[model samples]
Target: MHNFEEATSAFAKASDAISLKVNFPRTKHSAMGLKPYLTKTVWVLSVISLLTDIASEMLYPVMPLYLKSIGFSVVLIGILEGVAEAVAGLSKGYFGKFSDHSGRRAPFIRLGYSLSALSKPMMAMMVYPLWIFFARTIDRLGKGIRTGARDALLSDEATHATKGRVFGFHRSMDTAGAAIGPLLALWYLYAHPGAYRPLFLLAFIPGVLAILLSLSLKDRQPKPSGKRQLPALFSFLHYWKDSPPAYRKLLTGLLLFTLCNSSDVFLLLKVKQAGLTDTAMIGIYIFYNLVYALAAYPLGILADRLGVRKVFTGGLLIFAVVYAGMTVDGGGAWYGLLFFLYGLYAAATEGISKAWISNITDKADTATAIGTYTGFQSICTMLASSLAGWIWYRQGANTVFAVTTAGVMGVWIYFLVVLIPEQQKSPGQGG
Candidate 1:
């Protein structure tokens, strides 16, 4: 018995030594000196996202179809989409703040990913439309929890000079997953007609894989004392109150722009209205994601060379043009062009906008600023989506497009006349 106990002790010590070796933090020099393509943390997280997005997009492209199949109305679809987005936005801010307070990102990340993974399989069991709604909400809840923590981890891992490149690369990988996901769903749909449950079950596999990959990530060390404390839940009120007039004006301009930018479901509906079949719509969407994935990194590089605001404004202008084109009588080809340009607009602004926000804020409060910005934008989107639905129901799709175009034009005028001059004088001018 004594010999057996000794053997068990020896095995425990051996296991401890192996864990220590495997979990040792990489040297700062090693992390810093990594090749752009071979950065360990970035690559690991990218793979995590790649797998998770594959799961996410599988459901994303088919969600509306499922709703329609179950006899949901357009208004109901808009509400669901808006609620999902709002929940995600609100949760992004809250979970980001929670992560900052905890001084640990990994646990939240693991929990979030695990929750999302579980939610996907549960989608298969959803019978009623309300059950599906609950499933979607749970899925979005996981997204909200993961997004902020993952982004904060990315920022912590990157050097300032290469932040654009790092984030751009990550975004590209994410969109590439999006590009593949829809195609995968299309194939599955074709293979087994009306078998969305099997697809949902298949989604669980990738999500689980992503969570397993996340377990390998090393958490950031806690920041030293003398840093600013995290603010309270209502901190945004104080932040806006204390911010400079220029900052206030910029936020206002952003809000004005977002108020017009409704849910992308409207665009999908437009494709349907324009006489394309469901399979054709998915094919067009796949093309749009291809454009988005291909263009995002190049646009980020351009933002680094030119300026984020300039690239962002150009995107807004493109949006204005696209909306105007949508207002005009157009065929299926025009809808395709509109979707492609929409992808371009997304590539121009998505990561760059966050980068710009990071540049403007204090380093200690980086997560807070990002959360606040996202929260504000989400509120605007919620309003815009609801209004778009109403406008489409009452006035017409053309009128909704016309109104959105006008809002985009207004943003352009504001940026040109007001924000540009103030931006030039700011400490971190240009990209």
Candidate 2:
């Protein structure tokens, strides 16, 4: 086990490696002197995300294997994941709303990271199914608690013009951690085969580092709002009705698209059906993450240069092509190309959507607006996965792929016809 001092030292080293020292240039976007997009807060928050993801991903690949070893059936494992995800998804909105009402981001950020860090060792110490479920829920719950506030924190750091760049850079760093985490797990498991318990404890190192970094953030008190009324647990749902027309329009398109976007597991399963080796599948997934990490920042910059709506619509086009490609029979090489394109699709949409939303909504409502969308987004994702599974099991993979492709086209049309026009008519809503 790493001692506190060793963990702190590792955190310092990582901070030094990932830290950005930006020399902002005066541009049309910032004619009144440069607004530092890559602020210290942005980089610090991103580093915290990178470290936490590393910790979580290190355990993710081995989770099922470990669960089975501890006597959980396939059905039980599925139930565990479903429930854990539901908890995480629902809490994102509640906590996000709570953070906004309280006018504090740092406390939620700190508590969320701390809970996740503490959950690591708890997993290693227990083998009971209930205990494992409890620990897993804690891990995911931490994600829900922090997501809105963290993104809002990122949003607060940059202006409308720089939102895409800020978010894109953060996504790049976060995905880089995802890539690094699984490799580290593979390395450890290679050296000490079947030593999964100790690996859980080992993941704690990076998690602790994340928590320590989160603690350093100082909260800025937001201006007091007129209404301090406490929201219901599911009160974020009400935000949809009260939010701006542009926000509602954008969210409708986003949610409609999300309803068609299923889990990435289906993609892996597709390649598996093509007779690729396990090693090849893992390598391909890592390659996809690397592509996403590399492309996110550049695509974000492109979105800033062009328009966020344009780039986001372009991503949907890419999605349509990828799914259409999947319908054709492809071997490993062709599948590789599709996955690479898929990564680009993710990079273009994920951060860019949030940037788009932040630009159009009131700053005071940043967390609430994002929280509601993400909250419903999570539910839509669950439904999409279930619907896709049924279609794949009944109709077949190619049929599901075709269906998804058609859905993407419909969404693309809706964006061009409806959402874009709505944004254009609204004052100061262009991003």
Candidate 3:
């Protein structure tokens, strides 16, 4: 039975943490010019993310192709993506809320990576699309289970001054693994053309590594605050009610943007449409990840310096332009530029959004807030993907891209009018 004043004070702390200027105390001798400031947990989590993404990307790029090979249509692929993401979305808040009550993050993380690792074998043995769906859902379930708890753990380990850098560094490593994975997948395909089974098996190695890496992170029970008994799961709804207005506002803005941003498989399909072979398509994916990895750290630092309000808004703008470009029947250069801009937009937005949420919630509710935010956003993305698939199936690619661009534009405007003003209202935070 926490009082409203207690909640208010905690909310104020969170807002201040997120709204600090560049003049805040910074750590020198850091890994990426912000070194000695970050903790071991951040680096460890980065390693875990890197390994897990390697395993994921290894199978992911090929899965769509395999689905098509097995007589699945684009709409089916979209539905599959939507359903899988919806499962992940719904699970995140539950796991996060549970983690807050239990106050142990490592178990959920270990279990998540292990489950995903096990799923690789399922993919390797798949002879039908349902098998693929089962494997992908299992993997995404693992992702859903770990993401909230892991992110909460990172925020716990980092100081306010280092939050952006910590998340950014993690994303860079994660994207680096994404870059490496496609290369490995490409090699396997090159060496053994049309042989997907071996590639699936090879993916198992990195997933295992990710689980092992989770062992490096430490977890502890919460200090006995003598609060009322907490429910095991679904308590995050209470967390939202208790959290600050700014957090909820930011979540709404992010959700708005995500509703228009569907699963990226369609983009891959677009690249294929643009005249690249399977191998070349993979090469471009590698290129996109490289750009993402390169840009994430710098953008993260920029977020810490300049404030996330503008950087995040700028990211939405990039997405809008990229989607607009995609609507056209472009040459190679147009598609390449679109993919590259997407990479830049990801660097600017993804980690920053998590960092933003982490900065705006109570310390005790970190996992709950992050999980809730990610969960809702992902669910919206599922709906958006499903809609995009329906549109693409019926109206064609031009209409789908144009509609996406329009949706993002609307979101961008909402951020400017509503989301940004709340942050600006606080003195000392950048606009």
Candidate 4:
């Protein structure tokens, strides 16, 4: 009961912290600059993402180091990440389809965030490989549950014209938390010097706050359809056939790109292998996210005005350059530039792809379409990470990166020649 009381108090405080007048006043002079493109729901959801990402990213930069400290090899780490991502990928489809089928979004959001919140503390409680995997899977399971529904909520909140700005603003806010979380971890690690366990518990604070904030969101539930069959585990796969040809074409390029774009952990590991300290590694990560946070919204606006296809493909080009740069023998100096470009790559592609997908799909199937795409994307990411890890183990990091750079170039050409032309002719080019 005392613990319950403490949680209630925490919720009240978090609610107050997020109140419009206090934090993001609705006035013209508001900190975030109130705009018609961003609605209350969008703001609320962004804050939830911001808080949740803080919790997740706090652990992210250190995860590889922590695993190594516990005697995990690079290959083992790769397998673990691959498996965890696979679980999240598969479930993203199922839950996304389930959310669409149920005509409700808020319940899934609430449950998902809560599970993620609980998983934060779970990581600090035990050191066993199975226990760690279980905790990590819970964290990713929460992500799978909410991503499609949450993104659909964002999609519903904006028109095709405004999708870029809305999603961009949300990404900006979310990445801001990503920046802040790592900084906090960096500070904690500086003072404590390798005391990683306590940081996991610290992450739980923001996660709980995210859950509390998410509670305020109310889904516009559609009236029930009469049929009552449950969605199949891989039912979201069916959307591939039902989706527009443009969506399928775009997704083909995207999935191919993902097949080479391995986990970011490999990047951090690269820095570590170069003899950089933990502080230096986290510092580089912090810089990358800061660049991403700063660039995401402005780039989103650009995508809206110029064209999402232009912006997304341009980002891919940057991605190729960054990967190519990664093949160089430069020290911290070159890494900073590469990560800056990488950040730009992330800002351009991540939200813009979703906005593009949402624009092309029927409104009713928004969740299913995105769920299926991301679900497949995640599976591809798993394979990519595993493959990169194996290559790093046998051949070398340079070979892994070189292969990725070549893949990105091919994907970029595919997007420009194949996907873009098809999108232009498609009926859904409204964005």
- Cα-based lDDT for every prediction: 0.74, 0.85, 0.79, 0.83
Q: Which candidate is the best by lDDT?
A: 2
Candidate 3 or 4, higher TM-score? 4
How many steric overlaps does candidate 1 have? 0
Clashes of 3: 3
Give the alpha carbon lDDT tens digit for every residue of 142-230 in model 4.
Answer: 99999888988898877666687678888988999999988788778879988988889999999999999998988866658697788
Alpha-carbon RMSD of each model: 10.2, 5.9, 7.9, 7.4
> What does candidate 1's lDDT look like per residue over 80-192, in tens digits?
76787878887777777777666777887888888888888887785676886788788878887777677777766554444554566678788889988888888888898
C-alpha lDDT of candidate 3 relative to the true structure: 0.79
C-alpha TM-scores of all predictions: 0.82, 0.90, 0.83, 0.86
Off by over 4 Å in 1: 1-38, 65-82, 126-133, 223-237, 242-247, 420-431
lDDT of 2 by residue, 50-136 (tens): 898899889878988998999999999989989988998899989888888889899889999999999999999989888999998
Ranking by TM-score: 2, 4, 3, 1
Q: Summing lDDT over every window of 10 consecutive residues in candidate 4, give the lowest-scoring window.
A: 20-29
- Model 2 lDDT at residue 281: 90
The true-versus-predicted C-alpha distance at residue 182 of model 3, in Å, is 1.3
lDDT of 2 at 50: 89
